[model samples]
Target: MLKQTANMQSSNWIGHFIKITAALTAVFILCETVLYLTNPNNRWTLVANTSLKDGISNSLVYPAYAVDVAFQDVEEYPLTEPLIVNPLPNIINDVVLPQNDTFLPVHLVRFYFGLPHGDSHSFCWIDCISILSIMLYVKPSKIYIHTNYPDYWPFGRCDMITDWSLIQLVYTRQRFHLSGRRITFYKHEADVTKYSVAYQYGGIVQDSDVFHLPKMVELLRDWKNKKYQCLLTREDHFMNSGFIACPKGHPYTHDVLLRYRDDYRDPPVLYNSADVPWEIYNKNKDYQKNFFVDYQMGNHSWDYKGPIRYKEIPAWHAYWHGCDENEKNTVQLAKNSTYWEMLHFILAEGRKALIAVFPTTVKP
Candidate 1:
């Protein structure tokens, strides 16, 4: 009778322990999900659902994986052929072509990479939205996406994207040719490539994160008539490398490239790109006229930390509130938010007026 009672007690204890373990596991998962959803950076990982892979070259380069992730249940969305360029030509040694006298060639350049943990397959909705903004506003002749992995094209959300012909994937070498030099940080690599591409192509180089505005078109048109070799924007007191427009063989861009090639070392200098331009601008006061630094252009509230003085809603609020764990819910929220409003404005009257009007002072 005692043995039976002990057995019953042991069984009851085991059941209780199992229940407690499961409860803890559930709580942990809930916490993880909440954290991931709240963080904007994690949205790409959530949407892609891709296994993180090391070394971009080792991964298989195919559109099938992208299509599967981007268009899983949508039957109406048809597959489209993506334009890709394998083994991008070495333009480093090539002579800088003469500037296009009529207008800055409508070529737009952007660099995309999944570095630190190279997952070439990962792309977010914001990336697509940014591209769409550029397409709608700037209407570039060609949009070059310089990437380490050439095979991986972001076609997952092609249904939302309009022009496939505008996008061309150019494969860039992981190492620089100066004594076979390699950049330790991917950000530096982007800095070097931006100048190189601008030097070679003689167009606009914009960061992938920035959304192009309608006024940008007018600004570019105005730049063509001016004598400035490059047009740069100011973020706070320093010059930002985010948006740059210059002609082919511009001396300013060439100088920036030389700085990176000669001065850049293993322990990377933080903000080397931004600093180079800022220093150059200050040192050569006479040459300042050659570079147009617009204080108002590209300035937005996203990076601003000041109190809410303006009626315009902060971009962070729009993005964060609109994001959700469910892809459809996220999409729907984005459509209803200020982001969609801006896109619509760009589409409707972007050619005639500015989509975003920023107050001169957001600082407290």
Candidate 2:
């Protein structure tokens, strides 16, 4: 009878141990999920203190890897991913556009473009010229060209960095998701960073399509001479980002860029690259009095109304649909601007097919 009692006690002890082990495992998993949701940027909190006045690129964990992580993992972990800013190259060559990156409190300008990791592609000829032209037109004290392919921008006129990592770090640091619904895309990467740069550095952030015009040149020069904390122009409703200027560490930029996700999530329309920053302006009161709705500053090369002013001088030009290749637009383009000038682009691009089919004769 004593032996039988001992066997029963041993079996009960084994069952209790199994239950304890399973309970501990469940607890561990629950704790991990909580930690991930609460502190998505990780325990490090690297970008929380990013005054942005002093870039901490030197401190990026693995400079290049941060960009690689953005490209690979953005779709999976949009808001919570941790990213590092790649270090800027030590030596900038002379051929670069502007001589210095003033890193000034204000009068800085930034632009963004998407390219493959390296300089392997044809690197669209119009984009090359248009981008360089926009920078010169702004005449900024400091210029930042945000791109995935830094290799192509070696000339040193602009400080080139990976915008992908920049935007990711901003979202994670700001906890931007709480603002409402967070959406990520090829265009948002450029659009969001424009806000970040304006908040941190206090400068202009323009689109790649814009070009130099006298009005834009005058405004940029004004920032250098005296007291202009920030300047943004808007149409009746839309806030045009083609030209924006701000004082370094502006409160407006902080609220719009960082705290946005905390209050409102739904924008009437997405802030896609083509449209304006209307979402932020509409939601935030601080932005209204500080920024203005100016016709000249917000003027487009071609308005929704379509009284084409391409031939005339404007603050900045947006060749908005330079890519439109419809057969009908071909003749209208010739009437509006210099369509005949681009017939060469067609021949240059289709040379391989043209040669394969008509190898015997040269077109007379």
Best by TM-score: 1
Rate residue 73 of model 1 by lDDT: 17
Residue 190 deviation, candidate 1, in Å? Answer: 1.0
Clashing pairs in 2: 96-155, 97-157, 178-261, 179-261, 179-262, 229-247
Which tens-of-lDDT digit does each residue in 234-350 have in candidate 2? 655566655566655455554455433334333533443224356666666656655544465445445333443322433444445343343344555555454222322222323
* Model 1 per-residue lDDT at 312: 39
Q: Assess the local accuracy of residue 162 in candidate 2 as a C-alpha lDDT between 0 and 100.
A: 15
lDDT agreement of model 2 with the native: 0.42
Candidate 2's TM-score: 0.47
Q: How far is candidate 2 from the true structure (C-alpha RMSD, Å)?
A: 15.6
Candidate 1 residue spans exceeding 4 A from truth: 1-122, 176-182, 265-269, 297-340, 347-364
- The numbered model that scores best in lDDT is 1
Against the true structure, what is each candidate's TM-score?
0.56, 0.47
Q: State the displacement of the C-alpha of residue 202, model 2, in Å, after optimal TM-score superposition.
A: 1.8
